[model samples]
Target: MRCDTLLLSAALASVATAGRSLQHVGRKADDSLAAMYNNVARNYASFSGHHDEPLHKRSQHQFLSNKTSSFAVNGTGIPDVDFDVGESYAGNLPITSDPKDPNQLFFWFFPSTNPDASKEIVIWLNGGPGCSSLEGLSQENGPFIWQYGTFLPVKNTWSWNKLSNIVYIEQPVGTGFAVGEPTATSEEDVAQQFLGFWKNFVDTFSLYDYKVYITGESYAGMYCPYIASAMIDENDPKYFNVSGMLMYDPVIGPNDIQGPIPTVAFVDYWTGLFPFNDSFVEDIHARDAKCGYTDYMNKYLSFPPAGPQPFILPGQDSDGVTSDECANIFNDVIYAAILVNPCFDIYQVATTCPLLWDVLGFPGTISYLPEGAEIYFDRADVKKAINAPSNVTWASCSDISVFVNDTDSSLVPSIHALPHVIDTTKNVIIAHGALDMVLLANGTILTIQNMTWGGKMGFQSPPVEPLYVPFHDDPVEGSIAGSGVMGTFHTERGLTYAGVALSGHMVPQYAPGVAYRQLEFLLGRIDSLDSVVPFTTDKNFTEQASEADLGEGNAPQGYASNWTAPASDTTTVKTSPAAKGIELSLASLAGVLLAVFYLA
Candidate 1:
């Protein structure tokens, strides 16, 4: 079924302008913000866990017989139900690891739409340190997406569950439907809690043999590395085979600290916005010069609060600097510039804002799906059907106090755990949306550039290479129509860095097709990371393209100007197929026209 063109157009336009038009102001008094940081630090320092206990002894589980009673009639008696064509299981499972902090983590699991006993199992989390992973399910790559203003779901043709069993868990104690006093203050605590949950989930489901892949976006960037590391360190391969991890628009620390400032500057110059004045830009450059490195901003931002001082600016003599200046520049100058440009979205520049500023102070704009899903999930009948707690309110994004009090340890660097992950896992994919300004692609690239894996410090050769996705329209027989350059990929020593074009922080929602193809490549369904030549209906083209990594199919016929190849010596330019003179169907034409008109 086609989407509502008018709704789509409006969404595109709004999302495009959402982050633009902020009013920048001068610096403010440091005491208030400084106090906030001090409180945060105190919260961080106050956190204590059962660190003395052995890792294996920390996890405890209790199976609720009542919770399984509502499951759809599958022989296994799991909370399984048919949502359209696929099977789903939704409810809460208890983690009694720390009896003092008993928590029930909510999970929504969907079996692969295409049944395969040996298909991989993917566990997905969304990073807020408090955000619900249900957003990833209903809004991003889940089988059914919530239709705004309607109490119905639309089938997402490109759902990730097509070839993998996907599980979305609302983690930490206080997130989503999970109930308990929030106690996890560090990623280590978060990982320990997850390990407890995983043991119960896998044992109950009898899924010990399935190959598992840990995945998430944003803050999950931190969570994934730590979780993957813990799984590797604790679980035996015979019982829990952790294949890999995939991070989308992640907040990998250190590199991500002051990364936004330089990213904003580069984007402004590239897009001809010149948002920063000469004085501010000169100050930034002068600071960089004093630090003797271009990435000094990130270094400064990465520093933790030592006593009262949170950060020390370059060339400063005393450690009396407050974090207020850094916060002001990020909010007032950098973010404000993006807010002023209706054409630029901080998450995805090509799209308009789909979110409105909340009356409550949420750092980013809240999405409509979470609100709609909350309504749908909270319905009495739906709750009965899913066997969920009827009284608990379903929240898309959790309360900020959860972060302030229970997740302050997120400030601790999680990137330090990636090396251990790379050494153990089959592969590690660090992907970012090219248009994402929140966690910029350049920052991810920098992080990867500085990483060491397989006894090597970095890639010995040039890393950037054009990544192509098949044109959905008029795919050639047996071969794909290389329609456009969707993104770029660089792989070295089991570590891969990818830039997804035409996407935002929520990559699966913005560019589902490319995102799906990227996952296929990561899963080894496709031969190479750069080119995607799916087996097409046309026998001749498939045979030809199958022979070489560079397929024999003609370049894309109709969509040439959509994606441009990056300027690099290693980049390979492919010729688009000759135009077949096939006009788009009226419905397709109308949708295209609406998008163009609204975007223009």
Candidate 2:
């Protein structure tokens, strides 16, 4: 139940596999895996082992059973469904053919409000590596935001499904209402399963003509790329026309190393919450000087100090230091900063004081949400209406054990995979909330600046340009009479890097209007990328509003407001008991690995 306890369990499990290389860790597939592989080889022989074979061909549970219904939809619990009866589908689609270890993935599909079926099919995923897309559906960008206080759903005016058919899929094997053992231990496996799910999804819905755009926030950043790559590798344009991908506040880099450094610096520099003492600052500088971290912020990929060089912390010595020790120093500073901040919501800096600190330290579920979503979704009536499995309990995030044995936690294959996706896809857009500390905009910018795509290593022009989105108040919903600067965007060769202002990890939940316009641009619904001009406004004339009037409150709770400076200058850096346990676990894992190496 405790975050540290779960992390420790995961660490121990990971360390147990340290002796074997990833390639050889599970090379000899189990019976079920072998059967799945053989199925692919037999049916899709031409594409077998080509990475382009439809994952469904490899799945043992290739047939899909329909569990859809048109029962009385719960108005109080359902948001945006004004009509009593409408087209909606929810059920489990088998991802693998293995009968013994069937991986049935859960999905909720909402048909586009447009009846013509002319719109593209947009799939939204939430990244916890273990989290559910249902969170995105109910709390963030879905048609309804669950209001637990009244046990009612509020209409999300800017739902992505407004102009596109949106499907929220609970992926991998054990996430959300999906049923199976938590068998997937890597992102590659996840992609394979997702492709299989997609094949079933299209077949079941008969949506072969619809273009696909994959989008998600957080860990989905890592997921979208691999999924896109699979689609590209499959080379089936008729079945998989992946036009674009859009991600907000995604985890693009590997977690254990260079990824955490830029985030720590950005938070400390921007929030001023963790005011390091002069000695600490000087110590960091000395270490940086000695460790040759001259371009630490911009140049992070050239890290791990090449060879025999010792790893150094900013304010600490390099003597007898291991790579893990240096990584801890970077991670600790960020962790300590969160502990010191009154509102520990790392995704949104302006949160006054967060209530759900229990969610922290869990991968991908760090952001806060309304209280009653879990309860509401679990209700038998609600589950039945959506055709969810009666036996399975729905959760916003998956259990830590689902990922404890994961081999890809420290891997950044997604980053390397993006260029290939970009090369094949029509367009790719990466957006970040400017104020998010969890995955800072600065880090994202630096990563993009260092990336190679479209025959160029990086953008030739400046990486910052003003991005504008039409502003509209709730009173005047449809029309955009005025414009406001959303953030900055940098573009080159069908790839765009955007910074969304007054937002956090969940872009749609915070700045829905801007997010909607951004989606329009990515979908090619809008003509120009720089400007968004709304078509019409409410008949009741409204005057242009000031910045304060349009900011913060528009965002969900725990996501709006200015950072309230702590009253006292004296800052106390205290590590949580959970954090201490995590530290001890890491140390123990490292010690064991060292002993193994020496013994070998």
lDDT of each: 0.52, 0.54
TM-score of each candidate structure, all chains considered together: 0.67, 0.68
> 15-72, model 1: which lDDT tens digit per residue?
5433443444796779998677445423312222211112122112212245443443
lDDT of 1 at 312: 39
Model 1 lDDT, residue 592, Cα: 23
What C-alpha lDDT, on a 0 to 100 scale, does residue 477 get in candidate 1? Answer: 18
Backbone collision count in every prediction?
A: 21, 11
Once model 2 is optimally superposed onto the true structure by TM-score, how far is the C-alpha of residue 87 displaced, in angstroms? 3.1
Error of 2 at 366 (Å): 6.4
**Which sections of candidate 2 miss by over 4 Å?**
1-86, 97-101, 115-119, 147-151, 256-258, 273-294, 298-325, 354-374, 409-411, 475-483, 535-600
Candidate No. with top TM-score: 2
lDDT, candidate 1, at 546 = 23
Worst 10 residues of 2 by lDDT: 591-600
**For model 2, what is the C-alpha lDDT against the true structure?**
0.54
